[model samples]
Target: MKEITIDYALRATWQAVARMYNEEAKQFESTMAVGFTLLSIDPKTGTPSTALGPKMGMEATSLSRILKSIEEKGLIERKPNPADGRGVLIHLTDFGLEKRKDSKDVVMRFNEIVKQAVEAEKLQHFFEVTETINKLIADKKIYVKNTTNH
Candidate 1:
């Protein structure tokens, strides 16, 4: 049997969570990406089109595709941005709001179930470990190239 590494564990867990979300979203004729995009947009003020990519940690092309898909489904609309003359803001339509609520409910249920299943201390430790991992990556502590060539 192969030993499990930290990256493998993180990737596997995330894949499972994504698959679960996608399966739930399928009932609404949506995908996980679309639902996530809906949730990311501000419900009231709307979000700048350029900001969505950075906010969601998504690439522009991928975010653009998701935005287009949701727009076609009547889940969102694009409007001229008041703050930026050259930019547009993404707003959720009534249907989008409804779907966002559904997405929120699904996410909340998942968190609630996980909290109920795991001990609080263990959960806190899990959070700490993940945070540390993120910090290390963000700080460029991992994968530093060897200064001396072999």
Candidate 2:
């Protein structure tokens, strides 16, 4: 039998999930990226434009595109950051807040459905394992043997 790797499984599962969300998003003329971006931003105070990319694990160019689309849709407004003149804060408009709530509901529904289908212990372990994997990669321990700098 052929062996399946963790990376392949993660990528495949994520692709499926993204496709599912994209299908749902079509009804609202949005994409998975936009929905996720909406949820990631702070609805009340606003989020820093610089911070959103890292926070969402998104590349600057891709995030810039999404932000541009979101802004063009009248969902968000970029304002001068009072704390930093050079930085901008991305804030949700009233319409954006409404859409954000909808986005939140979609995410909550997905979680609730998964929770209902899976055992709590299994879910917890899944999270723990994913976290451990993330930590391993973030700390560069996974590639330690290959890197001379380590």
Candidate 3:
């Protein structure tokens, strides 16, 4: 049998999960992806696409296209900045707000189901593992190359 290293194990887990969610929970998946990526921005201070693209690990052109599609869907709004004519800011529409709330509820229910399946003692460890993985990939320091290139 082939050895299953940490990367392989993690990749298999993520692939299986991606397939499951892609098949059974596409709406929830997209909402979760968009929400986490977008909501990371401060509500009081809007962020430009250039700043957002790097943080979300998205290519600038791809993120722009996604933003345009979502905006056309009426889930988000984009506005030109008065401070800088070339600058644009992103914000959620009322529809987007309602969708986000619904998405949050769905995720909470899903979490409850997962918690039920896993042992209580292991639940905290699950969170710890999740945080560790996030720190490894999502930390700005780890992916500083993107920012420096921009």
Better of 1 and 3 by TM-score: 1
User: Using TM-score as the measure, which candidate wins?
Assistant: 2
Using all chains and alpha carbons, the TM-scores for the candidates as numbered come to 0.93, 0.94, 0.64
Q: What order do candidates take by lDDT, descending? A: 1, 2, 3
lDDT of 2 by residue, 1-150 (tens): 399999999999999999988898888888888999999999989999999999999999999999999999999999999999999999999988988888888888999999999999999999999999999999988887654555
Q: What's the true lDDT of residue 80 in model 2? A: 98
Indicate whether candidate 1 or candidate 2 has the larger lDDT. 1
- The residue ranges of model 2 lying beyond 4 angstroms of the native Cα positions read 145-150
**lDDT of each structure?**
0.94, 0.92, 0.68
Per-residue error at 115 for model 1, in Å?
A: 0.5
lDDT of 2: 0.92
Best by lDDT: 1
- Model 3 residue 145 CA deviation (Å) reads 13
